[model samples]
Target chain A: MNDGARLAAADRSARVRHADRAARFVADAGQTDWHDAVLWRIRGKRDAAAGRVEGWERLRALASEIKEHTLSRLDEYLAAFEEAATANGAQVHWAADADAHNRIVRDVLRARGVRRVVKSKSMLTEECGLNPYLEARGFEVVDTDLGERIVQLREEPPSHLVAPAIHVRKEEIAALFHEKLGTPADADDPRLLAAAMREDLRARFLAADAAITGVNFAVASTGALVLVTNEGNADLGAHLAPAHIACMGIEKLIPKPEHLGVFLRLLARSATGQPLSVYTSYFCRPPPGRELHIVLVDNGRSRRLAQPDFRAALKCIRCGACLNTCPVYRRSGGHSYGATPSGPIGAILAPGMDMKRYASLPFASSLCGSCSDVCPVKIDIHAQLHRWRQVAAREGYVAWPKRWGMRVAGWIVRSPRRYRLAGRLARAWLRHAPRRLRYGSWNAWGRARELPRVPDRSFGEWYAAERGKK
Target chain B: MKVGLFAPCYIDQFYPQAAVATLELLERLGCDVAYPRGQTCCGQPMANAGCAPAAEAAHRHVAACFEGFDYVVGPSGSCVLHLREHVEGAPDARYYELCQFLVEVLQVERLDAAFACRVGLHASCHGLRGLRLARASERQEPPFDYVAYLLDMVDGVERVPLDRPDECCGFGGMFAIEEEAVSVRMGADRLADHLRQRVEVITGTDMSCLMHLEGLIRRRNLPLRVLHVAEILNGSGEARNG
Candidate 1:
């Protein structure tokens, strides 16, 4: 996602959205312990179904190591995939950023003499603002997956990467289906809602000039793109359309299908409690005479590949597993992120584009580690967040007042004599601390906490005086 | 053995009783305990909150204070963890959480102290994940070590199961106040989980996290009391259980 765009949007929301409402909007969301409660329920079910699998952690390590190893040789893999893709009668193109990426996708569709496109869920496309770009280019695009279809009719982009409609209540979905897809107007049943969506998308699947799909994983061994979905829209989109375009980020490559097993195990279990997704489709050949195009979009991922502390972020499979278990994400609804791919993953990914602009995004996380706990490949989310904060500070993204305050903090803590003097003074200050601070930015501290009244003397002073008296 | 007491700044002033309890616990556990006069706060608040460069001078000062002690112990897990795990390129790194020092270094099988109550376990993010005191890994089967194991050893202790069990209580030093809405919500969520399990007293290694929860618990009028895990391991006195 564009940090400039997200920050601009977040800033605009800040004007109209009060801090109390913003906080309440997030708090009154789904539930308090929802992420934790839901994740455990999902995990407990998976553990039981999968039986006792040994080497779970090693598998994650190997997956992370393999991705790390692959990122180091990413250029070689990209070149290899390009060669193999071209040999297989598919075309490959590289786009440096979101605008460049959108242009490439639009050009491909325009050159094909196509004005209508169908799509499967792809966060890469969302990051590049592809749908709007294509629509602006005068092409009509329809989303095929059920969740995407619900969000598409609302004329809003997805709130989630995977489960795009997670924020909408079921009743809201029932009403949406009633108005958009012409389900029985009086009906509130999800089955009826699904049936209505199925009928509406079926015709678009057949008639669209080309189909766009996001790649979950692209295997280097077979030079194929992997799309894991429950709806099988990727298969329909890739198969039925005369032409298929797959938009994928650069970090999606692994050595072989054999390596797919380790990731496959962790992905579904972490994502939605399933042992494996309903469909794991691998497309290597143009399906029975249809043309295939795979656009390898960077949009800042190449820069992400070079950073030691952050390169691991490229390993994301878009499983939404991290979001599913993030306590912070559970509270703050995705719209608060004001960009695609909102959640713990989005908070970190937003800054990769511009450290100065999206500095607040990293601070959004509580460093709870739930995202890390549920992550399939073990992204040390909070650690990466801590790393980004340091990066942002070093790069001059931190404001001066905070920086000066931290400097004062560092100075006092670093010296026993100075700290002691400060402590003595602070004690006196605390004894007289008013309901509101007469100075400084932290009136919030006084608003909630009752400042402990200072004792008559410092503990050290008491210890020394008592010893002398004795 | 010479055990250096590293009293974190906040605990030294606001909660000296915690330091006193720790010192007495150490002496009772049979160590030649000494509070290093020049000791100061570990620079974690600066480091984790994105000012490691500013934290450098403090890091050096901490290294100097406990440089020669065989075991440096602190009442707060989060602070002691900063010494063992956070400080980078510092000359002095040997340190332990009071429980870890007691269980790992001293190997005290019995305490002259005791406590009786239904206590919930609050795992501080630093002590739990950073210090590897809790079983935290994605590669192997995870384990809960020092805190859980220590709590299990205490007399009359009933460890309540929290929903996420390991969810952070969200007293993230400066974060609790900086991002009060989300931070307090997270702490409140953690507290409610412990409450659901009907725990009357909650205990953890990090006092600041407990302080945050204690504030909320007190404000909300919940009967739950917050305890530092060290205070509990020192065990309850006659009539203090109430």
Candidate 2:
């Protein structure tokens, strides 16, 4: 397929039919409960990790301020970063869109005659559909991160940002390894499965001709690429491969090396509850024989930055803390989001990418505001979700039934007389309606919950009779 | 101080007793409270559904009705939050959720009320997180709960501890029907937590949440009951065994 067709296909697949998909996930009550418990445990661990710090909230605020500062004068920082990176002997490429991004990577690999590539966990690469694009053109792409590889082997998208394959069970992984990598069929132990994955990844890493990694932080002053990983696989891939390419969104820039300390302290704790990742590797310059290429992709981020209502999302450090703490995300699972980065952050970002396609994302939440509280960068995620709903409605993405419902309800609520009449009629219907009709298919609430029993008099009616003279 | 009582549409209709209890509770606390007759709804339903412009008329109506009051207090946190956060050209500053008004506005040091029942306190999301009426579990700040403090002041109110104190009851307006399956599942889990603690009555700052849980309880023929915090604090809960 052409790039446009491919992108259209990806967009189609990513359009979240949230309610329908969430219903499917919640249908299996046992699985939903298990998912909720696992994520809640992660949230608990994050709380403990964050609580141990003397000024964790302060660190989060500082990080948010630094990001806001960097984004405000992004043009100047981008120039500085390009100059510094070039001085450090690394080539930097700018891609205005995803098509340009995918093509740039393809051209780089083609020029180097790279046959096989190993990629660490990069949500940006997933966002650009890089793996599929490269594979279709006959270059073998293997995900090196253990969780990423599990999903790659299963031919599915990574479910969570940090854990990637968090939704999958160990028994399922053991079965997958047995089918694909010759592991013992009964090897459901986590350690054994991890060992098998490590062994399999080792061979692929050694044989790979190129490496692609996602940048955690790009320092403008130092011209460095920072990668935070738990498995140490990204370091291996970037060092062992003959050519290394780092893909990052424009929002990834941090002003100086000193500012990195604040984010580094918060990233792992909020992500996996570790004080720091096992591999916090920084690449300043390419190794002697290998070449380093940095692809700065815009891909709609610049547009988001231009909007004040959404620019706070740019402060995100890609921590999955919001997802772990989100009750909806926990019960619905990541796949229900049908976006690359599925959760509160994704809900805000996806709509800007394609309003018509991802309209359901913004409305998926209950506006519970927990995501905002746990956010390491203090992104007002729930507020953004609320804002995006307005955008969706204005853009004609909201369904007609809801739109008309709101319109009629709005008219009724604006006038006390109309509202009173509507209330009286509703109460009368509730009190006198037939059982089958009252609890029918049209009433979603009545499927599992009974509607409120109507009362004899409204509070307004009671007040007029008893307290009007007083 | 003269207060304007803003009972949400649902509370005004199906759960009028909670509104009555709120009025009585406020009066007993030595405040002059008036029910604004022209008040119907707070425009929250439209605003939260993403039609903010459509809610303008309702917001103006609210401002007009409660214009002269010293404070506009509502029994539902969800509705009050919408007024504070979403309403335009409305009296946002004067709008207060019932617990917030009692704790922060009235400074009620004591209550001459009691209900001998094991009650599960459902921390409605808007009250706990939006209004900052309590310390949300997600934050590592100084712990406080206005609703619980008021509950503690009443005699014989056994506040049963929940495994998950502040998780949402999934009664997000329109969310209840829009994402019915997940909504029901979330509400079910919340009820399960209360049932696990052997809670005889589930009470909260908002009747919307209780209405959702109560719907489930009635459907299943559960022994538990739901009461707004106002009813329990007004000394009416002890008389209602059903």
Candidate 3:
């Protein structure tokens, strides 16, 4: 589906759009609890891993500084990277948007006469709609990562960045495999499922004519691309195929090779609590007779870079720490976001892509600031969410009811006399109105929870009666 | 020092006792506390809902009401945070959440108060993460909670441990209604942690959070009570229970 259609499918109503999708996910309370517990366990593991390192906060500060510096000089760094990569026997392609990005990839494949392709996990490709774009043109693209393959078979967008298909249970995966991949009917064992996926992907890897992977960090000084993964799928895909295409957001650039250590140290630990990713592949130049293609896609990143308040978000290393630590994200499944790179980071990033469609994304959180706290590069995530809310409101994306309600409430709260009168009126309504009327269909707060019991006297009234005596 | 008492809109209407507890507690702590009669609400509700322009007047009102106090103290971290961060007129005003005022400003060493109960502390998001009243679990910083420290000083008060210490109670003002399902689920999960700890009363610096949890507890008819930390610190002999 197109971004507009996908966003529309996820949304039902202005008041309860995101909440409706989340409600469906949490309808199975047992499953919701299990999901919450599992993510919380991951958060706990991250905490333990981070606590083991001395000066972790300082390291985060340094990483933030490095990203900020690179972003400030992004054009200079991009030109340098282009120049260096070209000298290193790599062809660099620039895409102004998603359509441009997809067209560039297709042209590269067409030029090379490539048919079948093996791909690793790349949120950039997912954002650009490359898989469907390639498959539509008879390119026969297959995702080699186990989790990516499961979602690919199900024709679903990944619910997470690091652990795609995290929302899927092992039993469901077994069922999906049984129907799609011809696994045993009773195969629920994790090891067995993984082994089954390995056997299936092994064949595709060998038959592939080209490969596509996402870049973790593009070293501008050295013109090298770095990809980190536990599955080693990127290595298999890029090496086994004659032509390799590495697509990356322009924000992935770091100034020097030395800066890679700071990110490498924090990436896996922040993501999955592994001290380091098992495979950290750096490809500076292709082997003889092998084609290396680097597509640097803008895809709304330049617009994001122009936003002072939100540009810090570009500093994200795609660590799922913000996702794991977010209370709202844990309870509300990532798919409920209905955007690529779901979670706190996505909430901030997606709105910049399409404000009207992804308007509810910013309001998805409680503004708890946990996302900002856990972020390795110190992006003020929750602050950015708040900023986006204001931006949405200014742009008239907020619902009319909320806008009018806030405007009216603002007038009342502005004057103490009007506020006291409103408080008294609210109290009287709560106390004297019939239960049915007070807890009517219009009252969303009263649906699952009781409204607060209205006291006979407000604190203002009590203060006047007792403490205001002269 | 003269302190201006700022009760959040919720506390002013639905939770007056929490404001009362705060007023009494501050006075007892030797603060020359005054509740400015012209005070109403901080612009937090409007601002949090993304209508910062609408909240501008309320921000100006807050600045006018609490203009001259050495510090402006409120019972809620959520409201205090809004005032500190977004009060356009009083950008430099010394607004503080109740706990921060007590722990940082007063340097309060002892409390002549006691609550003979096991209490589960819900670290309200604004107070814990926004106000920095406590160390959030997400941080790699050393463990410290000013609210817990004060609670520890209370005689006969046993603070219970929770599995998720600083998770949000999901009471994000309009979020309680807008995202009702996730909000209720989050509150329910937080309550489960407290119930697991076998605490009689769940307390937090922000009654807004306790208010949300209390709504759920009252609806479910759970065997628990909610109180603001001020009520406990103000001498909990007068505290009401479910």
Model 1 TM: 0.92
lDDT score at residue A356, model 1, on the 0-100 scale: 52
Candidate 2 residue lDDT tens string, A1-470? 54644654675666579999999999998789888999999999899999898887788888888989999999899989999999998999999998899999999999999999999999999999898889889999999998899998887888898988888987888899999999988989888888888888899999999999999999998889999998898999999999999999988999999888899999999997899999899999998978999999999988888899999998889999999999899999998888879999999988989887799998899889999999999999999999999999999988899999999999998888998999999999999999999998889989999999889999999999899899
- Name the regions of candidate 1 deviating beyond 4 angstroms: A1-24, A27-51, A434-442, A446-459, A462-470, B90-93, B136-142, B236-240
DockQ, computed on Cα atoms, for candidate 2: 0.85
Best by DockQ: 3
- Order the candidates by DockQ, highest first — what do you get? 3, 2, 1
Which candidate should be chosen as best, given lDDT against the real structure?
Answer: 2
Query: Taking the candidates in order, what DockQ does each have?
Result: 0.50, 0.85, 0.86
What tens-digit string does per-residue lDDT give for candidate 3 at B1-242? 99999988889899899899999999998899999988888888899899999998988888899988899999899899989898865654499998899999999999998788989999998888888999999888989999999999888898999988888999998888889999999999899999999989999988888989999999999988898999988885335643
How many angstroms is residue B168 displaced in model 3 relative to the true structure, after the best TM-score fit?
A: 0.6
Per-residue C-alpha lDDT of model 2 across residues B1-242, encoded as one tens digit per residue: 99999899999989999999999999998889999888888888887788888888888888788888889898988899888875666656699999899999889899989898899999999988899999998787878999999999878889999999999888898999999998888898999999999999999999999999999999989888999999988888778845
* CAPRI quality level assigned to candidate 2 from its DockQ score: high
CAPRI-style grade of the A/B interface in model 1: medium
Weakest lDDT window of 10 consecutive positions for candidate 1 chain A: A13-22
Name every residue pair that clashes in candidate 1: A57-B138, A57-B139, A57-B140, A58-B139, B114-B235, B114-B236, B115-B235, B115-B236, B135-B143
Scored by lDDT, model 1 comes in at: 0.74
- Candidate 1 local Cα displacement, residue A403, angstroms: 1.8
